[model samples]
Target: MLEHGAAPPSSEPPTAPDPVPSPGFVGRLARRKPVELLVAESGRGEGGAALRRTLTMWQLTTISIGATLGTGIFVVLGEATPLAGPAVAVSFVLAGLTALFSALSYAELAGSIPVSGSSYSYAYATMGELVAWICGWCLVLEYGISVAAVAVGWGEYLDELLHGTFGVTLPGAVSAPLGEGGYVNLPALAVIVLAMVFLMGGAKESARINTAMVAIKIMTLLLFCGIGFFGIQAGNYAPLAPLGAGGVSAAAATLFFSYIGFDAASTAGEEARNPQRDLPRAIMLSLLIVTVLYCVVALVAVGAMPWRDFAGTDAALARIMEDVTGLGLWSVVLAAGAVVAIASVVFAVLYGQTRILFAMSRDGLVPPVFAKVNERTGTPRANTVLVAAFCGLLAATVPLGELANATSIGTLFAFALVNVAVVLLRYTRPGMNRTFRVRFFPLTPLLGFGFCLWMMASLPAVTWAVFSAWMAAGLALYFLYGVRHSRLAVAVAVAGRD
Candidate 1:
């Protein structure tokens, strides 16, 4: 007979203890070093057959600024200003702060472990094989789709310049991509191809072209900002926070995506003269410069036009200039600047993405062929071609807004992960030689993490869904191929034997 309160046990089997340790904030970070080992496995060492270290600190900073300053300021500002009003200025500040946290973390990690793969390599070194694979997948979406989205933006501005300067308009079928009643985005594809050619030639050539384009873009933006400030009317400031705090925060999250390219500076670690010192300097410097530029641009944009009128407008900066100057001349100049700027962004982003793939392939996380550098050019020719083809297809076909949102979600997710990695690394490897550290350690990273999470939450529900789906696919691939092929996993097994 059973005791009064006693009952028969249910048929469910006893639960198994968890296989992986519960990743507390600290415990999770302890995993960063192993991730670094994974990154090192793919290297031919710093002085190997890869492209020689040729980039100066100034070039790296310029590439970062050039990559980040394009579509976000010139185009997204108009869209976000309407949503947040004059508070868009505050939004830029918030986004910059958030970016600063991550940039600081990147500087420290990059200094200790200067490599070319960016966050994916960082994740591999700090997290594990699986996390590294997922990070790489996320980066593909971030950089790949961004290249395409930026290219489409270039097409719009190119059409505007052509029409304004010569009274000639390319047919919609030729100027726009399909579904917009266009046959192909000829200019967009052409830009991608040109970038590929430049990349395949060599890093020095690419850097020279990028430097020139960056100078042009910066000059145009400064000119616009200078002129627009004087044209500012106080009436535009009516209802400063039109959408209120919530809207401003939301806009900051979206606009933060505009700041994504600054990390590209760190990706050129292997090519920096003194990566440990210069990488951090370049990363922080570029972020600082771009933030100031963004703040000024946002201020002038809101001052020049009412927030309500900017919604759903494609090229708001050009539109604002046309409104203020009334001369088609300024519009043409702005349009030309937009075209050059967005094209430069595509070149920088695509180059970064291909290099990441090259590193991963060299590590055996992906096919080895991607790591194959052309001995003559010292570029990952196969990877560049494949990436360019995919980007071109997307630019020639897909809608820009969908691609932009997807890219933003991927970027924010990668950023959030990096901040978390920073906090984890602090306790796990306190004695690791860090050249540049985030000022307040746990607090700064925590703030950065919170801001990133906030931005992620602000994204459209559909964007989240898409991101989730992409991650799921990435996990499946990791299990199916990356896990078995990973160089780090093999190293771990060998260490166990020894």
Candidate 2:
């Protein structure tokens, strides 16, 4: 028997580590987060839970396609066609080329970086905190406003569906936004609410629903092309480029909104099962598929209808289907499909915005509440609810054209930063492992950056004004709050003190 006094002593349990300290104000803006650390933190949150990696490569591609295909072909085609005449097909091509260059850059960085912040995370790793914050702010404008813009477009198709199926349409007072002949847009608000409910469930569930909706959208557009081909007249093609080259450039800038979602998969990096390999494939594949479909549909649509007739047209695709087949049944079919299509856009884009905010919050740039993940659902529920409320209000009041242009400028700016980030990362981290790399090294990324600037310059002056105001607000917030709270800055300070 052992003596009681001779028993071995136990070790004291380790105490929890101290919370990171905040940094000083000056020069904190230029601090860069290490890429290795960012990668390590992928699915984790400062709020104490991990994001579930439930998305496969297939689901990722669907999210990208779902976010993109409908916004242009169903809703905004009418708006763009009148600006470029029959040569609107050329606008689609031009926009596709811009997207392609950017897509390659995105592919490399997504494979290398693989975080929920997308370009914002890339900039943080390669550039500095201030540039990354600017990129993230631009993303807020891009994804958030596009959701509202798409919701407003969805309301247009809902009106068409109502009239076709039941011979009743919502009155302007309830269906149109304020200052656009209506007091508020209830239908737009409804769609946002519906998407929010699905999002609250989980990302995997949403992706399943989106994939189904994307299939319906594609088949519907193809059906329209089949029937509308008979309505084409060669005379409709005569006045190509009625507004000339300047007009084409403008139309391309507007149409860039159509390609906005091709990068949606990049935002899902943390939620992807194998982000390094899958993210690059998902982005490039989705962009290629969408670009082909967009060009085909735009060519078919303009061939079937006169460009001038596109002006002031709501539910233009359904109107074209009805005219082509001389039956309400086809219009009903197209309208129903559009309802599904535009809803998917709202769903995917809203998901992207929430993820971006979650990333920022974890970095201590925004409030920690945004980084909080629900224990059961593996989602930032509060973030989703708050973003939905904001986007819903915007949908209920803002006009669609204004929302769309504002979105395009913000997207172009963020994309340009992403291109720059790629070149910078290559120079600094030459030995870092990369699953995907841009073909021409500096040339590819440089061209991508140039194309982004070209498109931004082509947007109207009013859009630039809106963008400048938004950037000013973002910078002010970053300096006042982000500077004081940044985790990287805090780490630097802690290291210095040690």
Least well predicted 10-residue stretch by lDDT in candidate 1: 1-10
The TM-scores of all predictions, comma-separated, are 0.88, 0.89
Q: Rate the local accuracy (lDDT) of all candidates.
A: 0.76, 0.85
lDDT of 1 by residue, 322-421 (tens): 7788876888888888888888998899888887787777767788777777767777788899999999998887766655678777887777777877
Cα lDDT tens digits for candidate 2, 1-498: 001111123232333223232355435666788887888788887567888899999999999998888857776787898899999889988988888889888888898889999999999887788999999999999998888888988898899789988999899999998789999999999999999999888888888988999999989888988888888888999778999998887888778767888999999999999998898899988988888888777788888889899998856777778888888788789889889989989988999999999999999999998898887888888989999999999999877575567888898898999999989887876766678878767888899899888878777898888889889999999988988898887777777789
* Candidate 2 lDDT score at position 164: 80
List ranges where model 1 is wrong by over 4 Å.
Answer: 1-48, 399-403, 495-498
Error of 2 at 55 (Å): 0.6
Name the regions of candidate 2 deviating beyond 4 angstroms.
1-26, 82-87, 177-183, 233-250, 306-316, 397-404
Best by lDDT: 2
